[model samples]
Target: MTIIDGKLTKHYARVWDYCHELLRSNPGSTVQVGVTVNPDQTTYFHKMYLCFKAIKEAIGRDASNQVYPIAWAVVDIENKANGKWFLELLTEDLNLLDGGGFTGLLEATKEVLPNVERRQCARHICANFRKTYTGMEFNNMFWAASFSTVESEFLRKMDDIKEVDPNAYENLLARHPHTWYRAFFRTDVACEAVENGIAECFNAIILDARKKPLLAMFEKLGCT
Candidate 1:
């Protein structure tokens, strides 16, 4: 599977070219492409539309054996209203993919490829936990268990929390199953491949870059 930012058309094109090259070089081998987008980026919706368009164009009239192109976007659901809007937009996009008159991209792709699967980010799940249950001792234990790979150990910790705070335990477990429970248990290779450390590294780079003003850095680098 190939993962890329949906916004980068050049990068997407290069990845598509590489996939075609690999297929031509080694016949009878299967390849799949996955594009990841952040919902916060306003342009991502348009980018996703274009991606489907490209896939349809590439596959041509007879898409009997065309490869599958899966598109995914992650949304932060801290604010209820904004979250609702994001979900609505996602539904609209899927509707378009399903057959909303703009193009028969989904129909062409579905002729050969399977349906697209939507997935939520585990990081957003953690953030939702932080938002809903703030400043509680159980929050630490819950987060620790959610982030840890040792299932037995995590369950043991959760059991201890339930013993002390049964109400909170039950409420959180029922309310946020996808976030707290499924996130820890779901076995998706692509999602599991993501690590908090990588996000932290990107954050650190952004912080370091922000230490100097944009113009100052450009001037220092002799670009101006």
Candidate 2:
């Protein structure tokens, strides 16, 4: 345990010191600290991302051989600033070229990765659709629209949705066809990935860790 000024470690030790300790212990690790500026020139705690060497190596050098465990962060809040900071650090650490054959999906990723082709997670898209529309038919229609690899096939499924419920079809349409529908997706990267299930899996695995203090959370996430 690290000692503080005349006391043992508190519920939460200083993040600044801990980040340094992490870097010292793990060589070739990337740690980024972000802060929010107040009107009075004061700064507030934001979030941070730690991309250890192990995580980077696990992702490999190319999509063909790469695993998708890119990086993980402990975000205090999922706001615009924090989102931008996390991706910016990731981009810098990964050294991904501007037009690198890569893509990111969802809100936080969208905010920073402006050039990379963005798509929607299939499960998330379906879950959001279910909030307003129900029934096995709608689920099938949604998947039909998403998994359709040909333009004509995609249109046919979309039309099926329109026939079932014009309002639901309109709602889905409002969410931009290119963002989720596979037919509209570009294969330049040859990623061939349509779902963000791996990222979601981390969410489940870290659900308990998220409730821990920042330092403990970082330690827990670093473990196998």
Candidate 3:
């Protein structure tokens, strides 16, 4: 089901039909949730329409000879993307009881999918970390700490950051490095991404479509 300008928009696509099957095959898949502002659409309840996207990976082929994990089962909805209301609907529809997800949507995930492995995007954290700390040395150290796969290596990298700037090290700690650092991520999911690149890529694919009128945007997103 798709909503546009607070109205239900019905569109038939095989993606919805195969959503269950795809998820079944890709058990424990990490879902990336993101909200993109739809500037061209608005309603009385909101100033800008929010396009909520939920994307996961599946075994598929982009070209005849290429077989790899591709992003599929993209859920695009036009509504207020904040709060747990939309997330509840999405999880109910997809039957996503437990999985991994980005930290931006952690609160809602806690309520809807409490067992989900919460991961914060290192890129987003770095953006905030840069506000108070800026320099090639600080940036390099921060990333090194995030990418460290071993506990000792992670601590060594963090000590490097601390030697450069104690405040910067404290800031990263406050943001909960456990959620963003690769060393703390669960091995059961077999995912190593410290960023929400999949969700961003899906958003980019619908960038132009999101600017269209309500119904038109739904059509494009459903078909895309």
Please give the CA lDDT of all the candidate structures: 0.41, 0.71, 0.60
Winner by lDDT: 2
In model 2, pairs of residues that clash are: none
TM-score of 1: 0.33
Clash list (residue pairs), candidate 1 = none
Judged by lDDT relative to the true structure, which candidate is superior, 1 or 2? 2
Error of 1 at 115 (Å): 8.0
lDDT of 3 by residue, 1-224 (tens): 23443333222233243344434655744333333445665521211122223333232224363333333323345334444555554555455655454233344466666777877888888988888788778888888999999899999999888888888888888988888888988887666778876566667777987775544564576577
Q: Tens digits of per-residue lDDT for model 1 on 13-106?
A: 4655655664576464334344434666654311111122223332122336322332222222234444334333434434444422222122
Candidate structures ordered by lDDT, highest first: 2, 3, 1
List TM-scores for all candidates, in order.
0.33, 0.80, 0.64
lDDT at 143 for candidate 1? 63
Between which residue pairs do clashes occur in model 3?
A: none
TM-score of 3: 0.64
